[model samples]
Target chain A: MNTSSTFPSGEIQRIKGCCISLPGNDIDTDRIIPARFLKCVNFEALGEQVFADDRKELNGFHPFDIPINKGAKILIVNDNFGCGSSREHAPQALMRWGIRGIIGQSFAEIFYGNCLALGIPCATIERRESDELVESVRNKPLTEWDFDLNKLEVSNNNISFKLSIDKGSLGMLINGSWDATSQLISQGEKIDKTIAKLPYLNDFF
Target chain B: MSKNTLYDKVWDLHQVGQLPGGSTQLFIGLHLIHEVTSPQAFAALKEKDLSVRCPERTIATVDHIVPTNNQQRPFADPLAEEMLRTLEMNCSKNGIKFHGIGTGQQGIVHVIAPELGLTQPGMTIACGDSHTSTHGAFGAIAFGIGTSQVRDVLASQSLSINKLKVRRIWVEGELAKGVYAKDLILHIIRTLGVKGGVGYAYEFGGPAIKLLSMEERMTICNMAIEGGARCGYINPDQVTYEYLKGRSHAPTNDAWNKAIKWWKSLCSDEKSIFDDQVNFNATEIAPTVTWGITPAQAIGIDESVPESSSLPKNEKAITEEAYSYMGLKAGQEISGLAIDVCFIGSCTNGRISDLQTAAEIVKGKRVAKGIKAFVVPGSEQVAKAAIHDGLDVIFKQAGFEWREPGCSMCLAMNPDRLEGRQISASSSNRNFKGRQGSASGRTLLMSPAMVAAAAIQGKVTDVRTFFKTNSDQSSKTL
Candidate 1:
């Protein structure tokens, strides 16, 4: 895990860290943090349990268990990462484990939204680029890279690859709008107006 | 862009405004919460010094951590008890209506909302559970949100979300006698792949979908999340209205007539445009089951598991993982595979109709020796209806345990769970690695009737044969 004990706050434009690659398709939330670990009322103490079952089965060979990948802030994965369950615990566990950004071939919708809500930027690259990035990270675990939300790209001293993120999410990340509670509450008048217009709220009157 | 579809109509109706980031500030018509995901959101609200904006629009229930067999207060697990206590305290403090245990209204959040008539046509629903898509069966635009979004909804009664492209999945022909909505959805997920529906809302239509009852439609929509769709919905028809009429929260008398008239206008227009469209023949779908970890890794009952060499290169990795994880070889027949346990309950297939159908198959038969089988109704209301119709007795007489209402053994947060590497035939949405409690436990996704049939034979048997046998016995009696 990262040496810093505090979580990120405010606008997040750039994330610089070593990357950890976990290659697979349809790696679900249940795998990231098992349901048994979800009994807690808070997300604290979840970082130690992320990929708990898989790491146990792999017996220290799992990417998250490898010593060199320690404190890796960027998680590189293959297609359809986080495919099942809407437990934000999946991303929470990853975030707590020092995953500040994620680059994958694709992401499941709810998982992507969850990451954005927590101020973690998730970007997509083509399959070939994602494969090459995972390879480079696995081969050179200590190489530092920068993921730029403003430029929508990941780059090191020797190589760079463009990333793709939805405009809404990209805007939210760079402008600190991802933590949506304050902004949503600021529009209280419009909210009341919309609720007033809804037929069911008035019992179809 | 999709135009004039039910998704389009409902989303437009709920738009509070456009946010600065181009996402819509969409108002949530109904917000459902549960013990597992709500406590943290409530705590976040307290941290922010905020309160629930519209308590009447929000509902809470305890299901994920509630024991199916023993639901008395002060649960055996202190963690579970603390979570429930936190939710109760939060709801009471905020004036949010909570359907706790023994309330007769308490059950799985997804199951109770619809039965109480809180889910309806042309509304927007948000819940902290992925199966919140089940409410989409009422023609509502419902999305599963995380706890942070839950906190946002508590403070503002809305979500900052981007509009999704709509995909109309049109299915023709009727399902055969033994095939059910569960099998059909499994087949769709298999054909579409788990990621096919990403970034899109699925509009299920055509004659095949219309033929399914409201409960069956809910079963179909409940697993839409497993296919990677955030939401799935069917346009409301007479079936939808009939299911909601006379329920606790539904409009009454003159308001009911007006509601129906408004709902009728919410269907997609004849010339509606869609982002994409796919067609299928329901008659061709058989009793499908998942032999692998992912819901998309499924096949018909008669087919054998595909060899990894024969599968596309993209699917090989997960296929190999599934082969080792499930302890099955490539080309092994799915039918007749021995099952150690049989479970028939979940948000996906735990409704009254689901229970009744399974009970019909197991009425005069007994569960096979050494096979542990049980049936958990989806909600208290579902349990009451099942007992009123004698479905519970039928299951119990067949040597199956009839348990109380909760999400038991589905995700297995409660005491009911699989042990060791035991393989189970389950009627739930997911069969992910370690989804049913045990780290190495295996699960096969199938219809509830298929689960009942498997329980009788102690293996994965073809349910069509059982239906034939029942018909033959009835003919003899006649």
Candidate 2:
């Protein structure tokens, strides 16, 4: 359903190592990392704050207290994930936590796009398949989740799902190119023609 | 292709062309940007060595990180300053209009567009913020886009959106005293559940909707996205036209009449078909508050937390989870949870009427010694308007902090967050975990007047108590 132009040009990377399984629907931006962390500019430092609101030290059972998920590189989740306010930090905080990929029934519209644009693959699967991953990971300790970026395939024996990564996003993840201007510049001719057709576009002209 | 309901008409009118993969490349009439999401998009532009394709179509503002308490430069947090600088540079380089810190127009993105007349009926608006649906109040089709999609809009002024199912929410009746538009929306979300509106655009209508002032209708539409609807809008009426009249960005003279004509024609016909329909009586709704992590986990102040057994079997686990996470007991009265803070802000409830209602509640009494209370106007214009009405003086004399406009304590974007384990009585939408800023902070959603009552009692107290105790409902005096 996507073209090569959607992603960057390069070899794709695959997910390797342990994954954290959060079983819930509609885990939102405010819950991913509270707005308190939005003040920081360096996305890399936001890892510690991922799901900070939910991880609030409480009842002696913090979200971050679970060691396997603390620094997990992949996140296997349930249906309709990331459904709430459109804070860009939601994906930024997730990426900071070294979560390279997510498997879920579905992702929030704005959030899915944000994650993919930032080189994070938010894969989609049926609810049953996603639940299987959640159950399997929850039962096992530090289980490996392997998702090949090139093949757009996720497999863990218990469940496997094909991903639909947009072309521009695919290219960026492979080459680590997230510069927006460059992405647009490469498609300059198309943009120029579109702008040229509308007299209103020439406020800058 | 479709032309019956308001949704179909608006959609067909705004369609530029269809892109591949069944997504429509819908043209945007207006684009609003805030400090939080635009930096990355601007960086993408710089990388391409490109400028905003249509600068005038886009408007920028600083909101997410601009402190309501402090407006000083080179902020205490270096990152905030840098991000603000990035937006400033981007707006300048691309010839885009930016309402920066301390600007007369600066406020929350949703609040500014309406006041400045940037958001108009029969137009399509897009923002990198989810609350962009707030613009849909004026009968515009507004969508919240991601940073990459923000890039797309800067490049094309169009968004690739999936078609939505149109749902007609008909509410008819006269609302009781103290029942604000915020309560109406909260009540709807409570009945429908948070995900009920997924893949839909709510067409808010019926006599009760038409009777609401333009600002009140705006408040209703602002929370549509919270219910997972693509957007929520009301049919343009005399109120809508009157509100738009003579506004700075509104069309002038002949253009204005033509615009209104088109806007009127876009309203749903009496028998216009909708994919779904729900009806409600306005009198049945009471001032609502959420006691749990989701907005739907709400009960009226007089009601008790529903017992877990009463919920469907599938919903039990989440119900149990919410009960534990919120430290709330099943069957416990939702009216007495101790509160540490009371905030009146956010695009949802930070309107002038909200401030006025809250001011009336606080006019004669001091805030409980231990309880912290503050009011953040939704926009600079709202702030100025409230000040003109002397609402700020009432707030200050009553011991509540009257701060500048922005989405303060409403998702914790600015400094107005909670301390550890602090429970807040908030007028903002959403009662999610740590939504008020503390990792372990708790929020109790309520009307602004209810928040004022809680501030006075330092607990989840009834707003009716203050109403009776005061013996004055018409005017507030310090």
Interface RMSD of the candidates, in order = 0.7, 5.4
TM-score of chain B of each: 0.99, 0.96
lDDT of 1 by residue, B225-312 (tens): 8888999999999999999999999999999999999998999868789999999999999999999999999999999999999888
The lDDT leader among the candidates is 1
Model 1, residue A156: C-alpha shift (Å)? 1.0
Q: Write the per-residue lDDT of candidate 2 for residues B22-101, one digit (tens) a residue.
A: 34556677899988878777776667665676788899998888778888888777877888888888888889999876
Docking outcome class, model 1: high
For model 1 the local lDDT of residue B35 reads: 88
Q: List the residue pairs that clash in candidate 1.
A: none
TM-score of every prediction relative to native: 0.99, 0.87
Best by DockQ: 1
